[model samples]
Target: MKSRTYTLVIIALAAALTAGCASVAERDSRDPLESMNRAVFSFNEGVDKAVVKPLAKGYKTALPRLVQNGIRNVFSNLDDATEFANNLLQFKIQAASSDLMRVAVNSSFGFMGLFDIATEMRLQKHNEDFGQTLGRWGFANGPYLVLPIFGPSSFRDGLGLAVDSHFTDPVYQIKDVASRNDALGLQLIGQRADKMDALAALEEAALDKYEFTRDFYLDRRAGLVYDGRPPASE
Candidate 1:
């Protein structure tokens, strides 16, 4: 039933993003379903406070720095596959090559991505996603949304997540179901642990946390889609 709830949450966010709304320049004008988004945001926040945050804290306290770095490297190696595929789809041959090289080098010399030898070799890590692919092809971002668990996204990005999960991500292709699930769980806990201090600062600084998060996510996504050089608004 917990899985069902997560699905419903994604659906609700998708619906909101797809609904008709004003332009981005108008500031929050794109959020036609603000009420629903806020509710889901609160629900996600409650879940984080009650379960994810505590688990992350425990995980951080228990793990040494070296272990934590290894866990992050493992996930990043997995990300290289998705990033390479997206780069190819977006017609970025150079980036795709770099991503492929990162995977090959790390998986071989880095002991199955327990380290990041590629970075030391000056191989840049490029972030790409199906959402960015769609954007490059002229697909609109639609509206902003605050999805449960997943946090902020747009209609395009939400669909991209689905595509990445089913197609691009190697985690799903793992033959052993238990191992796949364990890898995913570790990735989640590692991510949450890394975000603890940043999240705390956000809570302390933002008077309206929802708005702050929404704007920040949208801006950051734009930066990612444009490879950190988003065009200035008119």
Candidate 2:
């Protein structure tokens, strides 16, 4: 069943890419599915307003700073493995080594990542994902996409998310299914809570929220791919 879902997601991403290419010369050239994307974005916004925002607010209010930091640290530590793998794939030996060491330090001295001792030890963290891996391999960032619940993405990053979820996410590797799901949920909620302030500011400042979101996400992804200095063409 999981394999089937992965295959379907890949097929859909391919179709979206082809459609994006076919319409690149006209309209919202970089986002050929603007109409559909706007609709999805609206739905996502509604869901966020109805459920996510309230939950994030409550989570922020209920959790103490120390606990929240610990939660964030744990999730970040788990993500280090994914970063290590992507760094290796991108031929970033130094970054891969740093990520591996961070993971080891956090898992041992930090008590399964309840704290981030690696950062204090002067070990820098690197942001590496499958999307950046693809970019390093010369894959084009396809059209912008608005995923259900997930909000803004691009064809390339969307596929990268799928790959990470299905393969690299350590939360899913837990033997106890219920515990894994709980951990994943907590990670999502913690992230949402962490971003609440920034998101509120963005909502207040943006004239066209959709366009602002799309542009910001694209810019951020570009920086991530090129390690904070994207090329002029990108």
Q: Which numbered prediction scores highest in TM-score against the true structure?
A: 2
Residue-level lDDT of model 2, residues 1-234, one tens digit each, is 334435655665666666555553445567788876787789989988998889889999999999999999999999999999999999999989999999999999999999999999999898888988888888999888877766788888888878876888687567676787677678778999999988889888938999888888898999999989999987
Considering only N, C-alpha and C atoms within 3 Å, which residue pairs clash in candidate 1? none
Worst 10 residues of 2 by lDDT: 1-10
Each model's lDDT comes to 0.82, 0.83
Candidate 1 has its poorest 10 consecutive residues by lDDT at: 18-27
lDDT of 1 by residue, 6-69 (tens): 3755676556745434323344665656776788899999999998899999999999999999
After superposing candidate 2, which stretches have Cα over 4 Å from the reference? 1-27
User: RMSD of model 1, in Å?
Assistant: 3.3
TM-score of each: 0.89, 0.90
